[model samples]
Target: MEASKVIHAIYTDDDVLMSAVKTVKAEKYHIEDVFTPFPVHGLDKAMGLAPTRLAITAFLYGAVGLAVATVMMNYIMIQDWPQDIGGKPSFSFLENMPAFVPIMFELTVFFSAHLMVITFYMRSKIWPFKKAENPDPRTTDDHFLMEIAVHNNEESLTNLLKDTGAVEINIVNKDEDAH
Candidate 1:
């Protein structure tokens, strides 16, 4: 595959990075990616990314967990082997739902949390034993990096990034499959 040329702009502060993103966007330059040591609030918005649907998926997973808990409890308590506890011979699922509330709640939380984590990893193309996609290790400590594709505007883009307070800028050839 042919390699693509891109500009990497490194920033020291998140505030500078945020304004740089806005300025770059205003200049109609498409940003390929941004890497930060920690989550920067409003960075996604500054990059014009769409809202995430993880919350909806979490809700659906919780619903599924609740349904599974209900079905399992019903089969164990009412269908397979009925039990009379405290002299109450109740076999109805609704009648025993109060006691099942704790189990249902716990399963709901468990499913949502675990499934959301898996979904996030999958969506982000992150996998166990996969090579790191980060271009610079300093971003993992205290730097921010913004990648912009080069399309014969290298000179202007470099000038813009420098004007936006980029501490360092590098032009690199990146393989399309590297990500």
Candidate 2:
């Protein structure tokens, strides 16, 4: 496949990058991606990205964990093997729910956290032994990179990026086979 041409606009500070993003968006330039050394607050909103649904997924995972804990405890402490403790020999899940509160809470947290991590990894296409997609290594340290598809108006895009305070601008040809 033929390589797609893209422009890389590098910024020194996150604040500058944020302002540039707003300017670029105002001018109707489609930004492909942005790479940052650290998380920048409000960057997603500036980039016109929809809010993440990870919180909903976490809530569902927590609910599943709670249900699993309830069922497991009911089966183990009530039906599978009942034990006498504190003179309470009744094999009832509700009666023993207070004793299982800590377990329920821990399991809920564990499931939500682990599953969220896995979901994020999968959604981001970040797996073990995967190579980095960053065009510039400086972005990992102190630079922020904003990638924009070249289209055919490279001159205007370059001028606009330069006016937006880009420290460095690079034109990159991305071949499918390069990955």
Candidate 3:
């Protein structure tokens, strides 16, 4: 298969990039990706990306954590070694749920946070010792890059990007062997 050609349009300001994105979409061009130095609000919507489902996953993780906490606490404090405090020997998890509130809260937070990080990493295909895939290092500092696939309309696309205030435009060909 022939290697795909992509255009990288670099912008110095996020507002310009956002406007360029809207114009590109209006022209029915396919945007491969966009990189910004900092998060720009509503960029995903501009790119027509589906909403993220991380919040639902986080809620499920929190539920799992809460269930685990309840079971562990019940087994440790009620079944295995019941403790009597303040002249009350109530060996029941329900009666001692108040004391376990902090534990439940901590476990829920821990599970949700850690699992969400792992999920995001896996979903993003990021791992330790992985090589960076950034096309330009300047994008990490002060530049914004908008990547668009070229479909034999490079001249028009370049003109459109220039009109949208792109500071630099580069045409990149994917290395056939790399694929």
Query: How do all models score by TM-score?
Result: 0.94, 0.93, 0.91
Local lDDT at 67 for model 3: 91
Best-matching candidate per lDDT: 1
- Predicted structure 2: clash tally: 0
RMSD of each: 1.7, 1.5, 1.7
lDDT agreement of model 3 with the native: 0.91
Worst 10 residues of 2 by lDDT: 170-179
* Ten-residue region with minimum lDDT total, candidate 1: 170-179
2 against 3, candidate with superior TM-score: 2
Report the error of model 1 at residue 176, Å. 8.6
Candidate lDDT values, in order: 0.93, 0.93, 0.91
Tell me the deviation in Å of residue 103 in model 3: 0.8
Model 3, C-alpha of 22: deviation from truth (Å) = 0.5
The digit string of per-residue lDDT tens for model 2 on 117-156 reads 8998999999989888888899899999999999899999
TM-score of 3: 0.91
Better of 1 and 3 by TM-score: 1
List candidate 3 stretches off by more than 4 Å.
176-179
